[model samples]
Target chain A: ELKVEQNPLFLSMQEGKNYTIYCNYSTTSDRLYWYRQDPGKSLESLFVLLSNGAVKQEGRLMASLDTKARLSTLHITAAVHDLSATYFCAVVYAGNMLTFGGGTRLMVKP
Target chain B: NAGVTQTPKFRILKIGQSMTLQCTQDMNHNYMYWYRQDPGMGLKLIYYSVGAGITDKGEVPNGYNVSRSTTEDFPLRLELAAPSQTSVYFCASSPQGLTETQYFGPGTRLLVL
Candidate 1:
């Protein structure tokens, strides 16, 4: 079974601060995905890291994958109130199945 | 494109009652998936379909069933709803598979009493 774990399940940061959410997986998988979900809303894809050392960024969020370590990180730079949301990391295994982390809920205070 | 859509934004069902969650995609995706998100937890895959007439179980398949009769429609059926089944259900579709980004629906909030 593939297990995915994320750190700092709940984070409260002031606006303009920076933070990184770590996602660790138990199995070897090269494909990692980051998604964000607002309160009472469906998830939205943030980034897809397909290989080791793969990094993708959008706006204030960036995600990186290290396949060898079975780890992925989602970094939030200069956070804003609008960036407050629960973020999740998922590892792709067994061809088409995704195992997701518990998720990191971020609350940005203005 | 309307992307992926799910019906019944919210529903409340008593124990043992069954219901079907309807999902549709307009992007003509080959892969569709059903996932359930429990309170304060990540999503657990219930079922998935690679294409019309091809379906498979996912990580959490118990008490849930799915059918993909057409390329654009994937419906998830809950048999004998239980309190443990109360969660938000999301439907997603992807052009290819996990290698590609999956578009998600708004999700259906189901509460089993």
Candidate 2:
């Protein structure tokens, strides 16, 4: 069974602060993805890290993948209230299927 | 373009009942998937289809079933629903591309009491 673990399941940070969410998986796959979900909403794709040391960023969110260590990180820079949502890191399981982490619920206070 | 659409935004049923969630996409995607989302748990893949008439199971595919008879339509069927089956279901599709990023539907909230 492939397990995906994420750190700091619940994060409460003030606006303008920075934080990084860690995702570690137990597998040999190289593909990783990040997704965001607001309350009662579907997932919104954030980033797709394709290879070792692959990094992608958008706005204040940046994601990186380390295939050698089977880990990935989602870094939030100078967060804002609009960035408050649950974030999940998923790794490619058998072939093209995805196995997701538990999720990091971020609450940014203004 | 109605990228991805799911019908019956919400439904509630008792145990032992059955329901089928409808999902369709207009982006000419060749791959489609069915997933379930619990409260704090992230999306869990239930079933996926590589193309028309081809289907496969995922991490969690015990209680649910799926069919892909057409390129644009993939429907998930829940038989003898159990309380554990209550959750928000999402359908996604991906076109053959570099990363194959999936486009998701709004979602269907199901409650099995």
Candidate 3:
């Protein structure tokens, strides 16, 4: 069974601050995905890190994957109130099946 | 393109009652998936389908069933509703491969009493 763990399950940060959410997996997988879900909404894809050393960024969020270490990180740079949401990291295994982390709920205070 | 769509934005069901959650995709995706999100938890995959007439179970697939009769429609059926099944259900679709991004529906909030 593939297990994924995320740190700081609940984070309250002031606007303009920076933080990083770590996602650690138990198995070896090359594909990791980052997704964001607002309250009462479905998930929105943030980034897809396909290989080791793969990094992708959009706006204030950036995600990186290190396959050898079975880890992925989602970094928030200069956070804003609009960026407040629940973020999740999922590791793909068993032929397209995904195992997701518990998730990080971020609350940005203005 | 409307992307992925699910019916019944919200529903309340008593124990032992059954219901079917409808999902459709307009992008002609080959892969569709059903996931459930509980309070303060990540989404867990219940089932998935790679294409029409092909269905498979995922991480959590005990109380639910799914069918993909057509390329654009994948509906999830709950046999006997229970309080444990109360959660928000999301349907998602991907074009072809694992590397492709999955587009998610708005989600259906189901409350089983």
Candidate 4:
């Protein structure tokens, strides 16, 4: 079975702090995706990393993937209260099915 | 355009009742999926379709049934609603396969009493 694990399941950071959320998978897969979900809301796609060392950034959020290590990370820089939400990292196997991590809940206080 | 649409944004069902959650996409995506979101667990795939007439089970398919008779529609059926089945259901679609970025619906919130 393909399993995805995420560390620091709960994070509480003050505004303007920097943090990194780690995701590790047990299998080999090249495709990884990051999504953000606010309380009571559906998921919003954050980034899609397609290759080893592939990195994508938007605003204060950036995501990177290392397929050989079967790991991915979502880095939040200079966070704000609006950035508080649950983040999920998912890996897509060769069959193209996604297995998601447990998710990391982030809270940024002002 | 409506990227992906799900019906009955919110519903409350009594135990043993049945209901179908409707999903449709206008992006002409060939791959569609049904996922259930619990409290802290991310999305758990219940069923997926590669294209019209092809359907497959996902990680959590025991309590759900799905049909994709057309390219634009994939509806999930719940035979007997239970408290364990109460969660937010999301419908997602990608252009080709699992490697593609999935566009999601607003989601349908269902609660079993």
Best by TM-score: 1
**Candidate 1 docking DockQ:** 0.91
Residue-level lDDT of model 4, residues A1-110, one tens digit each, is: 89999988999999999999999999889989999999888888899888999999999999999999999999999999999999999989747578989999999999
Q: What is candidate 4's lDDT per residue for B1-113, written digit by digit as tens?
A: 88999998999999999999999999999999999988778898899999999999998899789999999999999988899998999999999986668899999999999
- lDDT for each residue of candidate 2 in B2-110, tens digit (9 for 90 to 100): 9999988999989999999999999999999999999889999999998999999988999889999999999999999999999999999999622768888999999
Report the lDDT tens digits of candidate 3 across residue range A18-66: 9999999999899999999998788999998888999999999999999
* Model 4 residue A21 CA deviation in Å: 0.6
lDDT of 2 by residue, A33-73 (tens): 89999998988888888899898989999899999999899
Compose the digit string of candidate 3's lDDT tens values, residues B22-63: 999999899999999998988899999999999999999999
Q: Cα deviation of A61 in candidate 2 (Å)?
A: 0.9
DockQ result, candidate 3: 0.82
TM-score of every model?
Answer: 0.98, 0.97, 0.97, 0.96
| lDDT against the true structure, each candidate | 0.95, 0.92, 0.93, 0.92
Interface RMSD of 2: 1.9
Residue-by-residue lDDT tens digits, candidate 1, A1-110? 99999999999999999999999999999999999999999999989889899999899998999999888999999999999999999999999999999999999999
Best lDDT among the predictions, by candidate number: 1
For candidate 1, give the lDDT of residue A54.
Answer: 97
Measured with C-alpha atoms, the lDDT of residue B30 in candidate 3 is: 97
Error of 1 at A91 (Å): 0.6
Worst 10 residues of 2 chain A by lDDT: A90-99
